[model samples]
Target: MDIISIIAPMILVFFGYTIGSTRIITGGNEALVERLGKYNRKLEPGLNFIVPLVEKIAIEKTTREQILDIAPQPAITKDNISVEVDAVIYWRVFDWVKAYYEVEDVEDAIGNLVITTLRSAIGRQELDETYSSRSEINKTLLEELDKATDDWGVKVLRVEVQEIKLPDSIMESLEKERAAESEKQAAIFKAEGEKQASISRAEGTVQAIEMIAQALKGQSNSKEVLKYLVAQRFVDANQKLGESNNTKIIFMNPKDVSEGVGELLEEDTHISDERIGNGSN
Candidate 1:
């Protein structure tokens, strides 16, 4: 080779070594260094250096929180109903060394583990419990995942169920049940209202009758007052019967009621005249 060609290769090698040896890790990130295919050291955020050919960056990833969405998967409940459940998991890497070395594709491993645990948890509960115990399910999932993924050097912050889908038949049955319950409640309320109203009317009628009896007993004959009230009630019954569609024609003697009331008035008038005569005497 010529002198110029030799000089060019040396300059390129020198620049390549300088560039490869220097490493820059930004905020919210971590790096792993491996020397000769073995674990060497970890690189933190900001400036870092590695021995060009002897050491290399094995894994570089963000240490901040990450979200993993588990797609809808079939899980059978205790009652044997199939459900489609989808969830989101919040996770963060605490120890980057074990995170990179312990598991291949740590996120995937964690996801699969979570799905397995989710299925187990759902299998233990009935379908009704699944709907009402969502918080409990999340707590169980977080606890299980945090324990299981400890070797993976990650902490599970939270697991939330995003969607839970029931079968069409189940939904229809629930709708019918709700509708029936509503109708039953309406019927009960109507019966209670009618009962209360009947009681109020009866109480009012009794009070009015008692007051009228008292007033008549103080001023005139109580028996005549009772007879008049009975006759008036009878006439009112006939009037209401005539207004009804059940057309039963009835004949009543108005003179009979008038004659009875007229006798009572004459007696009271005679008594008042006798008192006046006695007072004069």
Candidate 2:
């Protein structure tokens, strides 16, 4: 029994040592092995055997995509407008050794770097530009971050500007300015329309006058045409006076009316009575 007890302890110890030496790493993950507190080699995913007491696993890093959510940060624009901006970052570790050793905290480092880059980018643009040029700003930020984090064994896949908060006063003022501009444009358009209408009316009046003059010149005797035109004008005037309900009647002597009619008829005569009378005299 004493011999069996000693052999059982030895067997358990051997099994424990073997179990500790063997490591099963899953896919997309890498383990860094260190010998005597010094980096010895990188272990790929699978069953790997290491000297249990002499070799230690330094760090384990995953190669899968990682998402980092950045909190809202205060930024100043080129026009000195203060704003709060937030974003998200997509990244992955390319080299396990460098990722573990180059930076103390990878997540925090990336967060801070993003904040700084966003602030700097925002500072270079005005509030209007910042709102309009989000895509450009995001591309620049990704490129800068990728360059900065390359040494840390991280690859930035994408950077996105999620939200931007602006001051209420600026927004209100912009709206008012836009409204005023629209009103001014409308006024200018109205004035142009009036000017065009006036020009058209003047052109039409000139054309009408030219047409009337041509008609008069085409007549064989303008005197008959003038007599007919004067008669039409008198008829139109009489019709207008009759249509007015408030018109008042005026009394006239029969002799005066007869004399006026006789004068009108004599004035319309084609032959000159003055020449005939002079000949007689």
Best by lDDT: 1
Write candidate 1's Cα lDDT for 1-281 as tens digits: 69999999999998998888989998899999999999999899988889988999998999999999999989999999988998999999999899888888898898899889989989999998999999999999899999999988999999998878887898899899999999999989976876686578658756765566555644556656666775675577568657756346576774575456546656765787889899999
TM per candidate comes to 0.67, 0.62
After superposition of all CA atoms, the RMSD between model 2 and the true structure is 10.4
Global lDDT scores for all candidate models:
0.84, 0.81
- Superposition TM-score, candidate 1 onto the true structure: 0.67
Prediction 2 global C-alpha lDDT: 0.81
Off by over 4 Å in 2: 1-10, 34-41, 51-58, 126-143, 160-165, 208-281
Cα lDDT for residue 33, model 2? 97
Name the TM-score of candidate 2: 0.62
Best by TM-score: 1
Question: How far is each candidate from the true structure, as Cα RMSD in Å?
Answer: 6.8, 10.4
lDDT by residue (tens digit), candidate 2, 186-265: 98997687668657865874565345434554356643554445455445445655765644534335445434533454
